[model samples]
Structure formats: structure tokens, C-alpha cells
Target: MTFSAVARSADGDSFGVAVASKFLAVGAAVPAAEAGVGALATQAFANLAYRPEGLSLMRSGIEAAATVNRLVTADAEAQTRQLGVVTASGPGATFTGEECLPWCGGVADDGYAIQGNILTGPEVVEAMQVAWLAGDPATSLARRLLAVLAAGDRAGGDRRGRQSAAVLVVRPGGGYGGTSDVEVDLRVDDDPAPVEGLERLLRLHELYFTRPDPATLLDLTGDLAAEVTERLSRLGHPGEPDAALAAWAGMENLEERLAPGRIDPVVLDLLRKA
Candidate 1:
């Protein structure tokens, strides 16, 4: 039993999926997406092939509905599978097979799709849709998807309870080292509170992967510089404040937050607190 959504960013630059299930490692089986193509989730006897095949079909210029229809129609156990699809710059589509368990269904709208099987009630999907549609378009897709997934969980989620949760978001040159599209791919495979665990991981992901806004950069100077120098010296750093700050950030794996010639405000705060 699972509840999931496949969505594209309002700016058409990102796509992702967020899912929660009473199944172990639901992310490994339920969700798939590519930067410029589309995203989908297959549950309720999920056909793993739908992942790559559905992406291929969408990449070939198929819209969400046509791609989902083709996949569902060709499946031998079509009546037992639940599916959702959303293209990078097109509409969304969802399918819930007749043979799926009770309270199984879905909703599809422009740029997003939500679906689930063996959920508490229609409210589970409704809460997700409402949260999703009400989100700020400027918010990151990963955060938006997580917001809806959290709402669905609050609305009773899968009747069988939670065991796993995951979120995957992608954009051009968004992955580690900027050579791939996987901006974020996180999973809480067996946590009692997987959504919360997932949220924590998302925070860490942002801290390590995203660059700080220029407006948020804090220049280490004067008293702050002197204080940083003192702290660095006490921590066994032996150099100017700026160089030592860079070394500390590198040691903490926070190089992404560094600016060309300034310290990050968050880094300053972290050093102060430490």
C-alpha cells in the first residue's frame, strides 16, 4: 500500500516524485524520473518495467495520458496495477486498476499526479492534492512534494501504516558534481516515522548540495573576523581567518556554501554556536 505523487516544477526545469508506503524500500520500486522527460509511480502490484518504458515513451513526445494508457492497456495484470505520470512541460495522468484494494484511486492535473492504493480514504489523496496545489510555485520541487506527502500522512495515509518514504527530484546539471540530473534522491527505508526522517535528510541535502544566496553571504571582517580567527586558532587552525574558515568548511563538507571571497552567514552562525 502506497501514496505517491509525480510532479514537475512550475518553471518547467525540474521533475520529481515523493512516496510513502507500508512496504520496505518503496522508493526502489514505486518512483522514477528523468530531467527532461517525465516522472511516474507504479504501485499495487507495480510493474517495474513501467518506470523505464514510461520514460522512454514520454521522451518520444508522448503526453502523460497517452503514455499511461499504452502501458496500462498492455499489461496482463492491468487490473491490479496503479500508475501515475507527469511530463516535464505537459499535463499529468493517473490510473488505479479495478482489482486494486479498497480506497484506491488517483487525481491528475496540469504538472502533477497523485495516486494511492489501500489508503485510509479519499481524503488521503485529497489532502495531498490540496497541499500540492496550494504550495508556492517558487518552492523547490522536492520540498513541495514532501509537503504533500506529509499532508497525506497526516490524513491517515496507507491504512496499513508507514514503513518507508522517499523523494527524488531532478534538473539539468543538478546532480552531485553537476554532471547528472539527480538533484536529490533520499530514502528512509524502514523508519517508524519515515517522513520525518526524510525531512531531516532533505535539510542535510540542501546544506551540502545547494549554493547559498548571495544576499545570505556573510563577509568575515572586523570583529567577526577576529572572533573567527580566535576560534580557528583554538581549534588548532594556523592561518589567516579567511583561509582557516575555508579549511573548516572543507573539513565539514560544506564547501558548497562557500562564496568566492566571503564566508556564508550560516557558516558564521554554525561557528558561533560551536
Candidate 2:
């Protein structure tokens, strides 16, 4: 009913999980991660406790394989669950219980784990592993995870069909305003194409919450300033262009991209489109 990948960034500073399934709101059940600790997905009669408990074990310096072993061993219904785990260092681990439905299995290697149960076939998890391995290390962990999930979807995901999808990524100072570890947490529950929906949400997340790249900052001056002022005036924000732009950005939830005496290309493009 589900397929997932859990991974640590190439630099080992980030960790994430991406999953999609025939289950409703699978995000709420399958994925979990903590910055500087580890990530895991528990499905097929998921034991929710495995989330926090697994993170704790990883934080205490337990390796990924050991953490999976400990969790399954302690559970009386171990044969009914599937799990994948990756920590800040070393190889990851994947587990598929003998009692899980047909087409259930997993694969793991350095820094990543891919797993699924009741999937279309072994190809689903295999495609995910290929995508994860081939993804550009320079890309954000969230995007890489999404690519893996999308690959699983393209390869034929849950045998029952798709209903939900989600991506979770974490890193130190990666959250909104650097206030938390959650770098990206987007979900598409009950969607006909949940992976596609999740991709759109991830774009919005990057635009709104991520700070502008310094190299792309455009100085607010001359014709650009005049055009901005005119645009703001037309939008009923008549004032100094910078001040009006600031006010508008706050309202639009784009304050994260604001910089003194400059505008992000994304903000300017949005203004023009508006």
C-alpha cells in the first residue's frame, strides 16, 4: 500500500523521507525525521511509536541497521511491519516483514533506504533507489527526495492506486526564518495525482520561505524603481517603492526574500504578473 525513501544528504547535514500510497493521509503515518539525527518511514501496520523512538535511538548514536533491528525485535508484531531508516552517517537500512502483502521488499545502501509493501512490483522500489543514487548532490534534499518519490510513482507505485503523498526534510537552521529544523513538509492527501500536487506545493514553499540567492538580487534603482513604484501604486500601495514593496511582500508572505535596496527576481516577476 505504500512506497518510501529515507535519506541523508551527501554532506550529512540533512535528512528526509518521501512517500506515497493508496492510504489516506499517508504523510501522517509513514514519515518522520530530525535534523542531525536521522529519518525513517514506518508502514504496513505502522507503529507510530517507531518515529520518536527511532529518532531517539539514532540520536543516542545507534546506527541505522541497529535501530531497525531494535525496533522490530521489540515489537511483538514485527512480521507485520515494514521500515526504512537512515542516520547522519554510514549506510542506511530497510526491512520488509515476511507477512506483508505480495510485491513487498526493500533495498538500502550508503546514505539511503528504499522500501515498499503491496506495491506494483519490485520495480517501484528499484526505480526509487536508482533515482536517489542518480540525483545531483548539489540539489536540496527535499527536491532529491521528491525525485525519488516521483520515480516510484512513474514506475507504478502502490498496487491499489495513489491517494496521498508527502515529503519531509530537515537540517540545522533550515526551517522558516531559521527557527526550526523542518526544511520542507508538504502533503497531498487524497489527490488523484498526489505526487504532482506535492511538487507544486514544494515550489511554493521554496519561493515563500527560502531566502533569495545573493547572486540573483537586483538593485532597486532607476527604471526598475520607477516601474516598481508604479506597480505598487496600481495595486493600492502608493508610497516609496521600497516601503510599499516591503508592505506588499509582508502581505504576500514573501518577506523572507526581502533585502535592503534590492528585489528578488521572483518578487519582480510576481509583481509583473499581478
Candidate 3:
């Protein structure tokens, strides 16, 4: 019913996961991460407690393998569970329950773990690794991990077929209102093309939800504004001084830029029509 993969950038600055299943609400049950801590994905008879408890373990200096050992060892139903963990320092570990369905297994390494159960075969995991190996860090981890998830689909993803898909990422200070973990937590709970739907949301997250620093504004003026406005107009947006950008000099999407509150009119004016 589930197939999932977890990975981190070689430098340890980013981490992510991609999962899909015939089951409902996979994200809420499968993925968890903490900035400066680590990530954990619990499934195949998932013990939901592992999500929080694993991160707590990592936060207290437990490495990936040890953290996983502690969790599985403490669980009375360990033999029926599957788990994956990646530490902030890039230690990685994965486990698949011996009792899981056919083609259930996983791979673990220094910086990531790729796992699946009730999958097509080893091909599914292979596709995931091939995709990740080809990823470019210049891109967002959301895009990279989603690429792996998409690859799994190409190679016969969840043996039961897809219903929901999700992506999760965390960074030191990459959340709204400047607090809490969650750099990115997106899901397509029920989509005909869950991976593609998740990708579209990722694009939105990259452009708006992921804010560049205040210094980023300094480089945009004149021709740069013109270029950006052209890009916005092509995306069904108005290149004008809208309320959305009142806090800065740009045209911002209403739903995305409204978070910090104020709409910077000057920023909007500058962002309007170059």
C-alpha cells in the first residue's frame, strides 16, 4: 500500500521525502523532520510515535542507526514494522519488516535511505536512486525528492496504484512567521496525477512561500524588474502595484505574499511594469 524514499543533499543543508500510496492521508502519517535534528519516515505497519520520538532522539544526539535501533527495539511489534531515518550529520538507516509484502526492502547509506513495500520490484527503488543521483542541488530539495518519487511511479510505484502523494523538507529557519520547523510540507491527498499535482504546488512554494532575504530586493531594479514582471504576467498575474506586495517592491501572489501581512506599495510600484 505504500512506497517511499528519503534523501538529503550531500552537504547536509537540505533533506526531503517523497511517498505515495493507495491509502488515504499518507503525509499526515508517514513523514516527519526537524531542523538541526533529522528526518524519519515510518510505515509498513507504521507506529506513529516514531515520527516525534525519533526526532527527539536525534535532537538528543542519537545518530540515524542508533535512533532506529532504539525505536524498533522498544516496540513490541518490531518485526511487523518498517522505518527509515537520516541524521543531521548525514548518517542514514532503513529497515523493512520481514513480514511485509513481496518486493518489500530498502537501501541505506551515508546521507539517505530509499524504501518501499508492496512495490513492483527492485526496479522501483533503482529508479528512485537513479533519479536522486542525477539531481542538481542548484534546485530545491522539494523538486529533487519529487523527481525521485516521480521516478518510482515510472518504474511501477505502489503495487496497489496511487491515491495520495507528499513531500516534506526542513531547514534551520525556513518556516512562516519565523518559527516552528516545516520548510516545506505539501501533499496531493487524492489526485489522479499526484506527483504532478505535488510538483505544481512545489513551484508555487519555490516562487512565493520560500522567501529570499531582504538583500535580494537590492539586486532587482529597472531591467530586472521588467524581466520579473514579464515572468509574472505569463503566470496569470498582474504586473502592478497590487496590495500583495505592499511590504516590498514587487508584484506578489495574493495567497502567498499575504502571510507577513503588510503590502508594500512602493515595492509593488517598482515591481509593476518593470
lDDT top scorer:
2
Which candidate number has the best TM-score? Answer: 2
- The runs of at least 3 residues in candidate 3 whose Cα sits more than 4 Å from the true structure, single-residue gaps closed, are 212-274
Write one digit per residue (lDDT tens) for candidate 3, span 168-190.
98876777645856789999998
A best-first ranking of the candidates according to their lDDT comes to 2, 1, 3
Candidate 3 weakest ten by summed lDDT: 241-250
lDDT of 3: 0.77
Task: Give RMSD to native, each candidate.
Answer: 1.3, 1.1, 5.5
Return whichever of 1 and 2 wins on lDDT: 2
* Steric collisions counted per model: 0, 0, 9
- Compose the digit string of candidate 1's lDDT tens values, residues 134-236: 9999999999999999999999999999999999998999987788999999999998999999999999998888878898776777887788889878877
Q: Global lDDT of each model?
A: 0.92, 0.94, 0.77
Instruction: State candidate 2's TM-score.
Output: 0.97
**Tens digits of per-residue lDDT for model 2 on 1-274?**
8999999999999999999999899999999999999999999989999999999999999999999999999999989999999998999999989999989999999999999999989999889989998999989999999999999999999999989999999999999889999999999999999999999999999989988899999999999999999999999899987899999998999999999899999999999998
Runs of candidate 2 with Cα error greater than 4 angstroms are none
Give Cα distance to truth, residue 210, candidate 1, Å.
Answer: 2.1
True-structure Cα RMSD, model 3: 5.5
Candidate 2 yields a Cα-based lDDT of 0.94
